[model samples]
Target chain A: MSTKTILCIEDDRFIGEMYIRSLKKAGYEIDWVVDGNDGLVAARNKSYDVILLDIMLPERHGTEILEALRGGKEDLIPKSYVIVLTNFQQDDQSRIAMEKYADAYLIKAEITPKKLISIIEKIQD
Target chain B: MEIKKGPQIASQFWPEFIKQKIVLIIVSQIIISIAVGCLIILSGFLAIGSIGFWLILGGFFVINLATELLIVISATRPTKDLLAAIINVSGEKSTLTPPNPNTKEYEKTGFRDALQKIYELSSVKDKQKTDESEKKDDNQELSIIEALNTTICGFITLDKNRQVIYANKPAPIHTNVDGIKIIDLLFNGNDTLDSWLDSCEEHSVHDEHVWTRIPDRLPNEEGRRFFDVIASYQKGSTAETVLTLIDRTKSYIVDEENLDFISFAAHELRGPITVIRGYLDVLGDELADVLVDDQSELFHRLVVSSNRLSGYIDNILNTSRYDRRHLKMNLAEDKISTIYDTISDDMKLRAGAQNRILNVDLPTKLPTVAADRASIGQVFGNLIDNAIKYSRDGGSVNVTAKQNGNFVDVSVTDNGIGMPESVVSQLFQKFYRSHRSRESVAGTGIGLYISKAIVESNGGTISVRSEDGKGSVFTVSLPIYSTVADKLLASNNSNVGLISEGNGWIKNHSMYRS
Candidate 1:
């Protein structure tokens, strides 16, 4: 079996670096982008097994990127599972909209590295 | 002297007798009859002829009869006319014939003129009284308007046509409200006021509605305004609808600005906490094999404290959201055990760090409850965290879940320092901290409040029973999924769960009182 690959789109430098270091140490190939625009570009260029998206990002919102990727009747990246991880709390309507498109929604402050790894493993299984 | 006194007394008596018209007439008749008798007797004594005596007596009798007729007419005619005039005036009929100027009947009797003057004076007096009463009513209305004007709240009275009948000073502060429609003056194409008025008219009852962030009509003014408006249908008042507007602009703006700042601060704080927690998790995992037991325990405590800090941030954010009525709940059928399983590991870590034993008891088969899983997890997390924080060293914290009829009850009991009845009574209030624990315990005092908010929003109830020097038990009961699923699903799209608007729960805290 090949190694699983993950793409993390987070704006904060410390949060982004923490995700990269932890997921790399957990034996997964991880690509980190600090802004929504580059993250979307990287996602379109090469498909990863899992995509971790953050809501509040520079250049564009994670929601806008999700819309561009999978807002149609069919998923743009059919195999990639999208998990929304963010500290930003969304209103009900926005949350309901995100829930429809994303595989899971997790609060960043509530998730530890081990927990995040276990959640990713579960999704992969 | 006696003769002189007799004449003086006779003069006084004659004038008095003359004043009495009926007596004078009767006396005159008697005198005339006496004169006739005297003449007859004298004629007889003088031995006059029988025919002459008879003739003189007949002539005296004729004069006597004529004088009696004159006396009867003079005595009764004026009285009859005066009585007829009185009846006419009392009956409100102007039927009394006007006195002829040529005949001068008014000048002759003077009674008709006197009655006319009395009638005129009385009618004038009645008119004056009515005018005075009307003036009093006007003054009363003016004073009421003046009183209404002194208040900071705006008041306006509208007729059935929605035209402004009366407006206080604050009501028309921005516009000239005379003859303007209420909708035009205060609202620009907003149907809420119109609908509220219509509802009041339909129900014939007083109804209240709130309008938030209403902009000023004046072009130069800045900032938004809030109003608590009431529309009432008064049965007998001159106006159709009485509108009372309490300007909540200042307090409302202050609350909004404060909430905004809180939200921003909480968001900023969340990022750093997330980073710290993530790095700590990474370090704990990487050093798991090399670290000794005590070192591992110390690391775990760090992780727990960081998690606690994150929880505090969430509480602050939730409290601010609750105050602004912006907290949204998406409820679904979820198992209580499933939610408990997600937070039990962290709960154990927290309890162990505090040197408290943690025990969780869940039935093998438990009913599903109507809940928002993530928020409900936060509630359990908050309760257990509180249990660990408040418990004495080496004490135990127990979490038990059971199936109550039509609901599931989860109780978190702690053998802690406990609290008095006074603190228990105010346990679920916002920003309330017991005096005993205020300095010793580190809390924002909104955990239970937000927990109550979350649980109640999911169609559940949360309560606590505590005794000083003993312990505390906080229980939350949620309805079974099957019972409330249909009702919740029907309104799920629009309903944002429990919302208490205004400063309602500040003093009363009635939401969780029972």
Candidate 2:
């Protein structure tokens, strides 16, 4: 088996660095982007096995990225599993919309780096 | 005051004396007597022959005496009758009887008319006094209603027939409410307003309801409107049903904007906390081997504090959602054991930090309950958090669950400072903390309120029993899933999310039907 690649789109610098360091230590090739625009560009540029997306960011939203990637009958990145990670509590309508496209939705405050690694490992399996 | 009273009495007495016909009779009698005396004196003074003068004087004297006697008899008879009639009428003895038809003198004298006029005038004055006071009262009531019109609250009074009997200036701003049924004023009228009026009438009590984005018939530039309607029914009053409407549109808009800001702030605050927690976990893991006893303990405390902060954020979010009535619950068959398993580690950690023992005992064959897993877990989390916070350092907190006839009862007991009965009664109210606890403990005071809301929304009941100096036990009972499955399935077949069954806050979402 080969090492899996993960893309983390988070706005906070500390959280982004933590994700990179933890995923790298866990033997995964991970790329981290700090804002929604850059994150969407990178996501479209290359296909990763798993994508961790944050909802609120500068210039764009994670929901918009999800819509661009997986709104149609065929996915833009076919085999990538999208996980929505956010601290913002969503209203019912947006939450239902996001749930339709995202594979897993997790609260950022509730999930640590170790738990994040396990979640990624499970998705890989 | 004494001088004024004397004049007032004199003023009243003169009018009454002049109104009597006896004054006219006395004046006429006086004139008749004076003329008779003059005639007799003149006849005696002009004696041309002694015998003739004497005869003339006697004739004059006899005629004058007879005339005077006749005048006295006629005048006294009518005056006496008039006096009797006046007394009879004034004393409330009987209605005035008209003078004899044969005696035309009575009408000629105008005595009867005078008496009738006097009686009518006095009675009319009495009636006018009463009417004046009543008018004053009416004016006062009118002024109150006029003042109310200047306020934001609109007032409308409805008769028993539902007609708009009275409406203030603000009341008719939305519709031409005059002479129309109150129910006809609103666009979605009959369903909510009609039933609310019926309830008020049936109970004869005051009630209130809210109407959101009402009156589709007339849309304005301000967009949607909200009204907090208060209604009351008064038996035997001019207005049977009184309706007061306070336009809450501005406040409603403010609340919505506030919720948005809260969501934004929560996201900002949580981002840093998440980072802090992540780094702390990383440090704790990386430094596991090198950290000594106190250092490890310090690291654990830091993690617990972060977790507590995270819990506080959740509480605030939940409270806001509850206030907005936007807390949508997805209730299904959930196991109590599963819920406890998810939260036990956190609960134990919190209690252990306080040097307290935490124990959870679930029966082997516990039944599944109809609940939302995440929300119910939060409920347990809040209860255990309270237990750990309120208890002494070395006390123990026990959580147990059992099946109780069509329901599962879960109880959390704490061997800590208990609450008085008075405090326990208000424990679940929003922002209610006992005075002592408020001074000593740090809390938002909405944890139990949110927990209760969540539990009841899931068709369960939550209660607390406490003894002041001893301890406290909080119990939650949720309906067994199998017992309510038939009803749930019926509701599902009907295409409603959940059959309210009395819980009216739940919104219908097709996805949550299962």
Q: What lDDT tens digits, residue by residue, belong to model 2 across residues B57-76?
A: 55665676567656766756
Candidate 1 residue pairs that clash: none
TM-score of chain B of 1: 0.54
Question: Among these predicted structures, which one has the highest DockQ?
Answer: 1
Off by over 4 Å in 1: A72-75, B1-145, B148-259, B403-405, B493-514
Model 2 error, position B426 (Å)? 2.5
Scored against the native two-chain complex, candidate 1 gets a DockQ of 0.32
Question: Measured by C-alpha RMSD in angstroms, how accurate is candidate 1?
Answer: 12.3
The DockQ score of candidate 2 comes to: 0.21
> Evaluated on chain B only, what is the TM-score of candidate 2?
0.54
TM-score of chain A of each: 0.95, 0.94
Q: Give TM-scores for every candidate, taking all chains together and pairing residue i with residue i.
A: 0.62, 0.63
lDDT of each: 0.74, 0.73
